[model samples]
Target: MSENNNPPEEKKRPEGITNSYRERLKALKQARQYSVAGDIPKAVERYSTYLYALASYFGVTEDKLSPSFFDTEKEISELLLISHAYWDLSKAYDRSPNLHKESIRCLDQFVKFTNGFKYQHINAQMLKKFIKRKQAHNMKAFQNAYTKIQVDSKGCFIASYSYGPEHTVTNDLRKFKQAIVNYRLGFRFVEVYYNTSPAIINFLEKSGIFGCLLNKVFIRPTLLLISKSARHL
Candidate 1:
């Protein structure tokens, strides 16, 4: 197992998922055409090639595979499509657990990825909603520890806890702090309230800035929705 230092950048996730299915569909159709033409060997070869592609797509050795092994979104989608193809293959070959396992893998991906917000694709507004929820808890902790709160000149609400013990601060708080820095990059005033829950912590840990401080710091008390009218100002 050699690691690739630079993997190919994917097309946007939705497009990539669609294209994978389209390609496999074409391959299956071609195999069907060969079968109808009475070329059994060629049909089998085409299917074998398709199966190889599916295995490669999921990064698994065909003989030793499991539903648990397929984790990434792309891998799961690939497995789902391949499982459908396997059903098609059963018409030509003997049905076995080996062939049916792809369906199981698809269900595994669905269960694992669908149960949490982190796996779900969300928009900017939804993301902000999650941030606001997390910071609510952080704000409570902040208020309890350091009572100092004031507005800075740039319109940022600063909850200064410079003297507060570090132990009181959690990873979610650090992430909320980083998010505020990013949110206030252009605007002068952003409100920050503190508190947290699972949604924000998951976002923060994946954000690559969990423990890392921003060049500037703050957290938002509410989700900011700048409309067209506000943009002009």
Candidate 2:
């Protein structure tokens, strides 16, 4: 007889609804409503409660979560935004600035943790914008202590998805850097009013050399302290 040497398969993880998940979902919906209605404190309360539910129901620590029910990428992304969302809501509290900071930190961590992320629809571009925002926000903090300003470094293309997957690399870091530099100047935005429309995003995504990352938010180079090279910007 042939030697039998198959190892036992590990037990599959259970998928059952706990009372806490139901309560958390209920509260998440409430939080969504409150957020839309301009009642931020209630929204914050609901979100905090939802997190509590998450911690308790999952039988893990505050940061640990059930893999079956939710994705780690999405959960962490939302959590990072929580502080920023709170900051935007309650002007009286240290919510906005601090939370914005926290959000940036969380986002940065997430970027390091995962290979890539698609925020709403935009992938690499969203984090790039977030980095710009954080640079501006933190610059203000640094302004009090120093004279000269500072900005974050340029985008490093880990990979690109320009029409399926392109193993070929395009060194457009200069163009992206120019985009930020131009933004720091007084260049007006092209207006992203149809943010609710994914079709528009899809259209743009399909029609472009750069795909979805080429939205107007990132295009239209900054006006010159001195004019930059046309190709780079």
Candidate 3:
């Protein structure tokens, strides 16, 4: 009998990388369900856990991981720009004692990334301002300050504040801060429009459309409110 000369077949090893996005997405979906079900703590846990796994897969710290990790081009896309979906998980941490630090950490990483692009500059600045606002003021009070000014699309200004019977000096300060936030919101809106569509804004401005927008009668009263609030602050 002739000896067999064929070499034994070598079994192939599995690829080192697995796309875990499906699993991450499943976790996110579960989180949303839990959130809708009013199980907020579980939802936060699920989202934070998924974020940790995703960051580990990318070999980045959780705070540094970005949506670009999931992008084929590994660069900016409309998903990252228009959606801001990454902040969802981070904001979830806001309600948890242990997770709130992680929330700020993640926001810090995003703020750092924004420095690389001019379009994100205002967002980065605003994020930093938000962080400062969180640190310098009580969170509940800060939130109160955020809710005072309501500007409708029709250019109407609806302002509400509680000076209260005590009227302590701190109340005045709080009112001032709220006024500043309201003032910044207007500037921020314009910045967002310019950042989102610079070419269109430029065309509009050159055609005098932007001037017409700025000329709205309601704007004068809004500025006056800001002026009064600044003085009080």
Highest lDDT, which number? 3
lDDT of 1 by residue, 1-233 (tens): 01222224544434543355335545666777888897755766676566555445456655443445445454555444444344334333422344334434332333332222222222112223533565322333222211111111111112222212232222233334444444544222222232222344445446666322321232322212222223334
Over all chains combined, what TM-score does candidate 2 have?
A: 0.38
Model 3 worst lDDT window (10 residues):
152-161
Candidate 2 lDDT, 1-233, residue by residue in tens: 01222212334323332555545556766877888898877887776676566565556754443334345453655443433333232221224675655444333333332222233223223334544565444544223111111123222222232212222222343243435544634222111211222454456667776644564334323222212443444
User: How many collisions per candidate?
Assistant: 18, 3, 0
Which lDDT value does model 2 have at 125?
37
TM-score of candidate 1 relative to the true fold: 0.27
Q: After superposition, how far is residue 75 of candidate 1 from its true place, in Å?
A: 5.5
> lDDT for model 3, on a 0 to 1 scale?
0.45
In model 1, state the lDDT of residue 69.
Answer: 49
Candidate 1 segments whose C-alpha is farther than 4 A from its true place: 1-26, 35-38, 57-59, 69-77, 95-233
For this target, which candidate reaches the highest TM-score against the unseen true structure? 3
Q: List the residue pairs that clash in candidate 2.
A: 87-95, 87-96, 182-222
User: Can you give the TM-score per candidate against the true fold?
Assistant: 0.27, 0.38, 0.40
1 or 2, greater by lDDT: 2
